[model samples]
Target: MSSAPGADAAPGSNPIPAPSATTPTTAIKRQTFSSLKVRNYRLFATGAVVSNTGTWMSRIAQDWLVLSLTGSSTAVGITTAMQFLPMLLFGLYGGVIADRYPKRKLLMLTQSTMGVLGLALAALTLTGQVQVWHVYAIAFLLGMVTVVDNPTRQSFVVEMVGPKDVRNAVSLNSANFQTARLVGPAVAGVLISAVGSGWAFLFNGLSFGAPLIGLMLMRPSELYEVERTPRGKGQLREGLRYVAGRPELIWPIVLVGFIGTFGFNFPIWLSAFAHSIYHAGASTYGMFNTAMAVGSVIGALLAARRATTRMRLLLGSAMIFGVLEMFAAISPSLWLFVGLLVVIGMFGITVNTTANSSVQLGTDPVMRGRVMSLFMMVFVGGTPLGGPLVGWVTDTFGPRIGFLSGGLVSAGSALVIAAVLVKAGGLRVRVDLRGRRVRFVEREPAGERERESVVAGVG
Candidate 1:
């Protein structure tokens, strides 16, 4: 399962420590914003914020376009499916590619390609030549590019700030993404209402420049370079074998797969709720997304404060999030639903951020790209399966049924995985009036030293 030695740090380890007293507290203790202290990361994040917002804007407009052109929620789901289906197929290969190349250069290439595609879509829509097929084709192309971009970007965070700051960087990155989620959809909705969708697409296309510039401006000498995986046959198989052997790594991914497949089917749920159940227009749809972003930003902020990722916290958040999502599904009023979305969004981010940091911290640096790809493959790639299933459920049984299914699966999967890990990790869960507690005991079959699992806060 091991790769060559002298590779970068494993994502799963807390290799980097807090700066000594000689270092300024302000530089280190900005909570989630601490990662912003890195000059490269700051520039990267600022540009990413701009680009991410535009990306969200395009997503809203694209889904809206599909709905408008076909008047079918299933068609909208197909568009979502098109974007992630490539990940299901090529994500692992992309991970291998990430390990082989410098992430910054790879990101520049991918970002430029995506921008060109966005501009093409915008041109078609503005020229009145846009159709559902065009949207589908563009989405498929974007997904193809993202197969490489997503993993490279995920693993690239380590190079920007090294492993010690990587957790903060990951949280801040999520926070940045959520911030865009807050702004993008709302603005996209208004833009769609006031003018049309073409401008939104154009904006997203142009937004890629921010990131490209950031990449170009980075001080490459300051980067924390790691050992790149040498190109060879059988390396891909070795990557898979690496993850298959680690329970700590495998469980969280399994948790993410079930959760992502069922829990993160937000596109289908939001679209169905906005268009079908509520008859809400684009503005209302944007409001739903923004409300969720509010929670997500808060969740990301909270996650940033922690130094360690815990398995218990990851599982617990999923359990609660599943329940809340179900309740949000059956909300009687739109306002109440929006409010619930805020909380659900918060819990959802906790699960996601924790899982990401945990897996990265646990894996060796050399294997970061491949393991993260596997992690994401389960987390985001599950969409190919879930998107259509949820769409079918929304179309057939109703949107509420779709929500209930996702919630049940997410909650059930977490419970099953947790139950298994209680034995595998040599832990006991005690039930009492004081609530549930998981205590680390000695590994079974022989007495051994207690392995302290560093966690942020007990769930």
Candidate 2:
């Protein structure tokens, strides 16, 4: 039954009352932590913090274990590459799986698999039955899980926090990860010195328990439901087609691939840089990673304070990152090298966090999983394609040249992308002084629309 209209309503119409102040304003916010206002997000964040710390611990231990066994810089490179190779080969498919499955449920399966793998690796290591090949096998297996886990985690954040709090959530996620990086290596260093690398793996296996529990405890009613799209013909090809059409999407992927392939294989470079250049031991390697983590934490905190996202800042910062990587490569002292790494770490996170947020914000909902998978592919998966080459270069020409080469290539690639984006998008880079930021402004040349039409016809 329609009630009589109030002054706010038209004739024969019912007017809805304005929501009271007590009613939350859920419509306007656009950051990631807004989901934390919901109980479920808080629980998940808490659990993830615990699990991520342990995961970092395992990463440190794994690298150390490989170095201890083979004592070859190239072996560490191989280990790192193996762990990321599956993402190169299968990340796109994993994204397709993510879009089709219930994300939370899929995460549970992947997390459990991770736990079992960690335990098996630990047992083998502790029993003195593990070989270098065994480590490679386990690392490869874990990489496969990560191929799925990474995209799922990125998309899941959107669901947990909704759109409003996405930026904050993304920053906080980086904070959590870097925080783990900060503590993980320090703890692994002490533990490895005290007991063995096996215990570190065992602890990591146990750490998965928190996230597993959090998953089990989530209430079904609280879940954010995204419509499941039917699988279409050429789904993967379609995803590629969509990305190919967008300059913002395609350029960033290209930039990330270049940086990731050339610049960010620090794990492989770290051991060599430490031993060959710095003449340091395992403890020094631990110290180097810890210092980088400290800088990363600082970057994460700074990113958390931003009220808005800026893509130009990301591009400019990426340019600086290349400069810093070059500096880190040629530093004379170990102390200077580690200090340089801190600056490098800071900018690295800035570049990564900005790129990640840009990719997520830029994609269509149905296509998001695939887009993110492609992003992960370029950012992490592409590491292997260049990892061994970087190692061989380091081993052959000296670690300094390896660093120099990576820096030059990264900077060159970024500049090329910037030029392409400027021309393709008709984008003029501008600084907004009042906003204390930089942005790209779209400028259309005379008859640009008609020109586009002519070009379209020609194509």
The candidate scoring highest on TM-score is 1
TM-score of candidate 2 against the unseen true structure:
0.86
What CA root-mean-square deviation does each model show from the true structure?
Answer: 5.3, 8.4
> Using alpha carbons, what is the TM-score of model 1?
0.90
lDDT of 1 by residue, 284-355 (tens): 889999999999999999999876666778888999999998898889998999999999999999998888
Candidate 2: give the clashing pairs. 29-164, 30-164, 31-164, 31-165, 31-166, 32-165, 32-166
Per-residue lDDT, model 1, residue 96, is 94
Instruction: Give candidate 2's root-mean-square deviation (CA, Å).
Output: 8.4
TM-scores of the models, in the given order? 0.90, 0.86
lDDT for every model? Answer: 0.83, 0.76
